[model samples]
Target: MSDLFPLTVRDAVASRQGKRLVGPVNLDLSGQGACVVLGPNGSGKTTLLRLLHGIARLNKGQITWSCPKAEAQRRQAFVFQHPVMLRRSVLDNLAYPLLLRGVPRKSAQTEAAKMAERIGVSQMLDRPARVLSGGERQKVSLGRALICKPDLLFLDEPSASLDGRATREIEDILQSAKSAGTALILATHDMGQARRLADRVVFLLGGQVHEEGTATDFFARPKTQEAAAFLKGDIVEC
Candidate 1:
């Protein structure tokens, strides 16, 4: 009864300030694996992620989950592009989610230590989280999200400010989480990152899905001109 899956979005649409942003889109997600979302600027990738994570209200259509809406909400976590740090020590920041779940502080800190090690932030556990650099804060954000052990994790440009080594560390952590049965929906413009982490791909352009398929097919045999152009590093106009 703890499982949250078979998340379905049918003809979903969203708008902000009277301007259409995303959708007339359909998406189905179940089981476990990484689904990487690829799109250029203004393609509504973030909007789509927000929509799935229950942050943004839908203007039309339906989003259904196999479990109850509240259950699904509880089983999911989201890591934003620009992470906001709490005015607390790194260790506390990482342990906060578990603490909220009523786990003892010491027990939560122990789990937080393990997650920090996974994200390569164990050395900074005693530092004030808000004083850390952007990339370091992002690491803590990811650690906090992963420590909760959600069924699905939504990440938006998670490694944007990370160095090569840090990016690899984060990717490895994501893979480990996937092996632990947590599905991932990540949005990034970094094609290399997509190639490394994606099991499936959803390519968006002009607030619409230009292509959706297995990573293999989407990269090798894109079905749409926009997708083909995007894969070939050409500008995708309209």
Candidate 2:
């Protein structure tokens, strides 16, 4: 883990309108394999990801990237449950990120085409992104994220709204990204997904970490009752 991305958070706190949404928390995320965050709604999973991505400012504590901000930004990409697409063709949507980063147009298009093919949406390249199905749109969104060749990828319920087959496809894409040396941080409530994708698990409750450990241990013998209930498919009493 130490040899990975070496991300560290020291007593971090985030606030919204003077209300503490997260923190007095400490965490370390390595750049190897996938780290899955599991929790119920309002557990601050998305908040934590925003903080780490520098999209939200920390009110207290420090988030040390262990690298320059520019390098960190270039090495990371984030995908949300509802991915936004411009009113353009799927190929254009997929090439947007690379275009912003100043990659040559030809190179961007070529790379975007390759990614689209990988995600099984190449045929939709000429179609308007706004007209694609939910699953197809997500595939395009994933292709856009991967086109950057990011070292770290954050996914906020990437398959939350998809059907079974779509969910499996997204999971397969994540696995491929992991195999390509991209560190993945995923926020999901799906236990089955955790079992399939997580190497380590971070369980959060009330905006704080309840447990963190290898996925196998956490699922087999959860140290906390809340986690145990969650893993057992029982309602977690707040």
Candidate 3:
């Protein structure tokens, strides 16, 4: 696990408006299989991803990328719960990142097209992105993220708003990506989704990690009461 890729965090903390969203946390994620972060709402899952992506400033401690930031950023792609699309064609939207990175136009277009096909949205490449349905828009968003061939993928509730079929489609794509050697960090509340996708699980509560272990072990026998209640559909107190 350590031989392929490595990520480390030590006593990391993020605070805003007199609230500590994340704190005194220590975690290490070697680039391997998918690691799912699970917790109730307001448990700081989104903020943790942002911190790992370097989008949010850390208020304390350290996050060191053993690789270069640009390299890391290029090797990592994040898909938000509510994806934002530019007012451009689907192909153009997928091509935007590569273009900003100075990839040649022709190559970028080719890559975008390939990704569009892979995500099952090739036929809509010429359509305006804003006009797509919820599932279609999310598919395009996934394409945009994958076009870079990122080694690390951060997904914040990718299937949260999708219908059953759409959710299954996204999950299938993620499984394919995982088999292709991409390490995933997904934050989700869906227990079934987690069971299907996660190799390891990190259970967070009140801005702190409550349990971390193999998905099978964590789900079957959660070490913490909070996790136990969460899995049993009981409301947990912060």
Pairs with steric clashes in candidate 1: none
Prediction 2 global C-alpha lDDT:
0.87
Q: Write the per-residue lDDT of candidate 3 for residues 96-197, one digit (tens) a residue.
A: 989988999999999999988899998988999999988888888888988777888899999887899999999989999999888899999888999999
RMSD of 2: 1.5
lDDT of 3: 0.88
| TM-score versus the correct structure, for each prediction | 0.95, 0.96, 0.95
- For each candidate, the alpha-carbon lDDT, in order, equals 0.88, 0.87, 0.88
Query: Which pairs of residues collide in candidate 2?
Result: 5-31
Model 3: per-residue Cα lDDT at residue 209: 83
How do the residues 1-238 of candidate 2 rate in per-residue lDDT, one tens digit apiece?
A: 3233689989999999998888877888777799998888887899998888889889999988778877787788999889888999999999999999899999989989998889999888899999988888888888889888888889999998789999999999999989988899999978799899999999988788889988889988999889988888887643
Worst 10 contiguous positions by lDDT, candidate 2? 1-10
TM-score between model 1 and native: 0.95
| Cα lDDT of model 1 by residue, 4-103, tens digit | 7777889999999998899888887764589999988899999999998999989998999998899889988999999999999999999999999999
Model 2 CA lDDT for position 224: 89
Determine which window of 10 residues in candidate 1 has minimal summed lDDT: 1-10
Stronger candidate by lDDT (1 vs 2): 1
Q: What is the TM-score (0 to 1) of candidate 2?
A: 0.96
Indicate the residue-level lDDT of 39 in model 2: 83
Query: Could you tell me the lDDT of residue 47 within candidate 2?
Result: 92
